[model samples]
Target: MDRWVCRREKRRLAIDQENHLGYRRFYNVMWYCFRQRGSILSISNSSGAKSEQRKGKGSDRVVAVLERMGAERIYGVPGEEILDIMESLRKSKKIKFVPTRTEWGAALMAATEGRLTGRPGVSLATCGPGALNFPNGAEYAHLGGFPLVMIAGQKPINSSLHGHFQVSPLVSVMEGLTKYAVQIGSVQMIRPVFSEAFRIAQEEKQGPVSVVIPEDIAAEECEEDEL
Candidate 1:
């Protein structure tokens, strides 16, 4: 009878130890996942120069690439300069554009969508005042650790120094609020900048990335291969 009791006690102790070890392992995995989520939601500068090259048809190319990257919807306020790209997206059917009443609203919606889904969210704005309105949303995404991509129309490169109707140095304004910021002026620079922007926004420390597209450049022709 004593031997039976001893054996039973030993089995109980072994089961208890196994349960304890399993709980500890689960706790550790949960902690690791949380940490990884935080890192993916911020900007990391370690990716190097290869991440920022310009390729394709500048802004148009960017839209195509975003669609290819699994972006089914874009939230933003449309303006004259960005209309062409919007039209293209509409026709593609691969992505749908959601128009917002205000640029700020668009930004907020994009950030919120990104938070809910693991995919990156996109917001668009026209140059000048339109671009200025997005900083608030951008800041929200940055602090909230959401993946967001902001595209803004820019004054022609020639008018960048001078002042156009709603001209603002958008790239400079968005610098601190985003993980990455690029002003797309040349066709050759679009691919690299876009690749980097997507990388930054989706990294382990996810945040916002802004791409400013110059007016003239957006209308320029891109080589067939580049497209």
Candidate 2:
């Protein structure tokens, strides 16, 4: 009986020592993180630095052009493929991102807005299945002759890793639905591409226009404020 008690006490002591060591290690890690808090906060919390970094980016130029054209609202669902553009929208003073539950619902709203305002109403969709849901509203705009702009995000232009993912020849599918459908290939093309699209959407027999931006192109450096 005494031998068993001695063994139990030794096991208890070993467990306690192990727990104490674990606590010390956790405390040390936390202290290190606390020491790094200042630098981490400087990078993450500095809005000015972030704003400066965004000033001449391709995504920012797109935002600037849209805002200059009096675009105020964007309707759609958010996804990983379009995060840079989405972030640009968040930073813009004139444009606002309007979140919706369904892609078709957002397209419908954009269609209504365009019909009422006589300008291109903008809606967004991420690549693959998200963009596929847009045909309902695209068809609606086509039938009603309302000006609508559909901006679809796509994978990096050169990526071959999307076999099971969202990558596809999206512009081809959107071509039949949109009056103008084009994929942006570079930062310098942002202005011309969107200008032509907006113009076409407002022309006689106006309908939906589609613009696809690859992830890499959106991250490129913009040479001008407006295009």
Candidate 3:
């Protein structure tokens, strides 16, 4: 009987020890996960602070508005007229820039994205021929009621750097292909204009909207309040 009791005690002690060890291991794993999560949150906070400290430019504000509007991707062919926008896109973490071989491809991709996602898909292009490439895709989106936003670059409007070279009546052309089309003539108009465009693009009978931004305006510094 004593031997039996002794064996039972030994088994109980072993089980207890095993349970304790398992609990300790569980606690350790939980602590490790907590530490890892803390580190990741701190890194994100630091990066957010850095972005806040960075100077706000027109293109940066434009990209910011796009992020706020929930645009996840921008399809385009980069050009000299949109260098500032390209730089801003490169710095953005929320919205990815997709480079295409041609403006037509970019517009088609954006239209497809809009059709699939049920949100306004964004496309970018330079003035003149690049801007003109959007018509076919824009019309397709407009007719199909797929929400789309088309952004096109232009030479400096405030200066004569390009001297009317490669200029086209882009807004007028796009007006027929999209639900709404306008040119952003001032830095202050970026936020409201983009907001309205996004809103309109998603409204009833959803269709394409077009915006034209000049190179100089995109490169200009934006006021803090504007951001």
Off by over 4 Å in 3: 1-54
Best by lDDT: 3
Per-residue error for 21 in candidate 2, Å, reads 64
Candidate 3 per-residue C-alpha lDDT over 134-194 given as tens digits, one digit per residue, 9 for 90 to 100: 9988988888999999999998889765568899889989887888999998899999999
Arrange candidates by lDDT, highest first: which order? 3, 2, 1
Over 1-227, each residue of candidate 2 has an lDDT whose tens digit, in order, gives 99999999999999999999999999999999987997788877796676665556778878887887789999999998888889989988888899999888989999999999999999998888888888899999999999999998888876664464867777899899889989998888888898898999999999999999888788777644343
Q: Pick the candidate with the highest TM-score.
A: 3
Per-residue error (Å), model 3, residue 36: 37
Over all chains combined, what TM-score does candidate 2 have?
A: 0.74
Q: So what's the TM-score on candidate 3?
A: 0.75
Arrange candidates by TM-score, descending: 3, 2, 1
lDDT of 1 by residue, 1-227 (tens): 99999999999999999999999999999999989876765434334222443323455676677776788888888888787677667667688889899999999999999999967798989988888999999999999999999989876785545646777888899999999988986877777777888888999789999999887777776754575
Candidate 3: which pairs clash? none
Worst ten in a row by lDDT for model 3: 156-165
Query: What lDDT does candidate 2 reach at residue 76?
Result: 96
Task: State in Å the error of residue 78, model 3.
Answer: 0.3
